[model samples]
Target: MIAKPLAKIRCLKSAQCLDETTEDQIDFEVDFVFPLTEFDLQFVGCEVINFTRKIIERSQPTPKQLIGLAHALHALECLPAITPGISVEYGLQLRKGDDEFAEFKYWSVSINEESFEVTSGGSVYDSSVGSDSYSGFKLYVEAGSYGYRECSDDSYGWIESTVEVLNLGGVLEVSDDSGRGCIKGTDE
Candidate 1:
């Protein structure tokens, strides 16, 4: 079965239009209400907070308890962005032990590369990931366009510097996006 996020997160996408009433930047706010499976994220905002916050709900603590993410969090590691002339669309998928992949909000976040300045939000992380143990999760990324090992000058691509945001346990590698975007497994 495909794993699903426990909750829904809304985030600010891009507002690249002038308002008809006033010549001010129109605040275009909308909810990407589509269901997110194990780990695909579309805009990358509150969900990242939801994930990083690690606001776990335990049966003992009034049926819902918030833990970890006690202190201020470090910069997010899973924020995937569209690079100019880089990739038209970018996505991250969580891999299961079954070798089947679970997707976050959506499979691919269509990037508006042409827009002068398009900004979106990405949840840092959530659930019990980044641990030596199961952390209850893993991720998947195919080769060809999605291979991260392809990092270097002639062969290298842009890499996201990452830091584990959980208060308690974290993985061996800090950067979630192995090279381009995403934390593969507990070891990664």
Candidate 2:
């Protein structure tokens, strides 16, 4: 068993927007090679947000981000090395989109009843969906995607998108808009 990477939030957080219009966010996304390629689990990507501010990087990641990354890496690591994209093997199930096909390179870490699963093909999972328990926490890892809203308290907030947790070819590397931040799977 591997200890989850130590990722504690670096800033003060609130349960609700406190007069401030901006709130930080974190998202999780995992990428696999076309679905059923035979290979070993490479890495899990995680990211943090400071509302377009220069504050997140591989050195400092939030637990909300790390936890989801940990779980995703854990589940997929259980999968035996296969040569195809996503195949029906063991408990691993391949689900396709309902209407048409879309090019979604990453899968969202969906949580239900406190458990998590890697899924895509809908709304491209992000922060707003399961952000109740995650302070400044969001996962969809859609690069450069954010959702803005007026909080009930009248303050505004910026919800950041996903963090790609699994990449088959190599680590899914990402950078913030400022180009000063990056998200990677390794603690180093």
Candidate 3:
């Protein structure tokens, strides 16, 4: 099958502050589009923080920033092109956000168009959400990096959130801010 260009893929991520004690986030949905026969989709999520520092005006992300976004987009959009019947793995990394700038990185699994299931094994973190085992599709960027490349480390303690597409019959495990864990779907 001919793989579609990156431009053909549709991506949506939003971030906002709901209140002082909580933040509103929307990261995943069904019917998400996947392009590429065997590529990766990075920079697919977003987050909303308290806006601690002054953000540079009119300054779009730098080449590094654009790369982080493009890299993630490429990885996620092509989730269906990887080896069929096999789970694909991805790695995401980002530098600490300072008053000046932040660094990011993304290493993702192959795509498999013949299948709709895309599984990713990695860690995610943020203030609102604690870290934990993460795997799911439909990543939502509520604020930081808008689901772009982010730093990963065992020292970060727990994973914040991870977005992945699972073929029907797969499983999804997630953790929330209150430090709760939940599993979705069951293999029957």
Candidate 4:
């Protein structure tokens, strides 16, 4: 499942673009400060304030959350001029179990910026279908002549990152590191 931005957070705040009519500098910074507690985040709500003074819904966030948000926002800030119709794409190679020898299946692809959040508990797969199954999720950013072969299955295995936008370029390959079922693509 895709991670939801802190919608319940009430104290945290951020600043980014000045206006929708104006361009957002990639260098623009977004910051947040929230109380740290183990239980409040799980049961209570958190808040987020943006640059436009817009108070957005944010859930209890961790330090990792801040880092992920910063990375995604920074990448999107550095957009260059492109053809009007050009699009960005993302992909993932996912499988069950920690060991490479374990049963492996499923792949996920997305172009929506919201699909790159890195939070956990998004239901990457149906736990009931397979017991003792583990899966790893990866994010890819691609652009230009570089793209993955079109896939017909949108019912992908899982999505690992939701807050971070992917950069779609260079190579799109995934390996178990054990040399099992490694997939790679090179842009001509």
Candidate 5:
């Protein structure tokens, strides 16, 4: 039998804009809502915070003059624990000379009368040329444990095996299946 759809799912957007003529700078802000249902907010929130910090640290150098900006980007207080049927919002800001960008990570959770499924996916962007980028997904709660599958593009990247979890008593298993490919093109 097919599972029933969620009772309610909604997303809202919030934005702010600022233009400073004296400093010749402009700021634009927008809200990113993560639609999560039937998942632990604390578990996901911890991972999100850690992931955001890693991305920021790897993408840019610590700005001595912009300590506040750095702190704001890694603020964990912005995210609050959420209950089912509610969406959590995060603010994204863009300003001049900041080429740094955080790719939006997507997640979905489904719960039927008996079993549940959770999946999350996102791609990492490397600003520098010749660097590798990774895209992958993770599945939680297989036999009470978690498993994941990932793919990488570009040279010097390692291939990974696929992991699958069956709903029968949360048994976890891994397959030897693996593959890798690199896109060949000129940098325009």
Candidate 6:
């Protein structure tokens, strides 16, 4: 049987990125680490802190910022079997925000045998109302040395390519559908 939803977090207004062609685009890379300590699943009642780094890019005429939202369930999926009685699952989404600048909002739910509750954007979810729910965070990235690039020989135009990993630590070299190259993360 599917385990009951225990704790979840979600980002509603998360990230944004604007692309301008006039600036000098350089190739660069960055690594985002989600250590086990951040999940804090060792304790049943402790609050898990959800967070993401921000990225900004400057160019003539227009500037862009990248942002996104994520959710997780059965958190145990990413952890080693050393810990017992802990589980989580998660998902994420990235899109444009409602405002001109990037904005972010989040929700969380914690469960114990006695009750099931949800907290989102400083408001508590009404248990009486039947609705779908989930959990996660947000991330933003802007052009650095490794920003968006046009595919050398394709009609696909521009592609933003990068590698992202959760839990395991390693070096990943990747390319976009348009064949633009990107190297992300680091070995640890």
- Top-scoring candidate (lDDT): 3
Score candidate 6 by lDDT.
Answer: 0.19
RMSD of each: 17.5, 20.2, 20.4, 16.7, 20.6, 22.0
> 119-183, model 6: which lDDT tens digit per residue?
32211234454333442322211112232211122211111111122122212111111111111
Candidate 1: segments with Cα more than 4 A from true spot: 1-39, 42-46, 52-81, 84-135, 139-188
Quote each prediction's TM-score: 0.19, 0.19, 0.18, 0.22, 0.22, 0.15
- Which stretch of 10 consecutive residues in model 1 shows the poorest summed lDDT? 150-159
The TM-score measured for candidate 3 stands at: 0.18
- Poorly placed runs, candidate 5 (over 4 Å): 1-40, 61-76, 81-188
Error of 2 at 134 (Å): 30
Candidate 5 weakest lDDT stretch, 10 residues:
175-184
Backbone clash count, each prediction separately: 21, 28, 53, 32, 1, 32
49-111 per-residue lDDT for model 3 (tens digits): 100000111123355433333332333333322211222222333334344443222223222
lDDT of 5 by residue, 1-188 (tens): 10012211211111110111211231111112222333333433444444334334433423431232233222222211111121112212211222454343333332221122334444444466433333444333211112121222321111111111111111111111111110012111
Window of ten residues with lowest summed lDDT in model 3 = 48-57
User: In candidate 4, which residue ranges exceed 4 Å CA deviation?
Assistant: 1-56, 77-141, 149-188
Comparing 3 and 5 on lDDT, the stronger one: 3
Model 6 root-mean-square deviation: 22.0
Clashes of 4: 32
Which lDDT values do the candidates have, in the order given? 0.22, 0.22, 0.26, 0.23, 0.25, 0.19
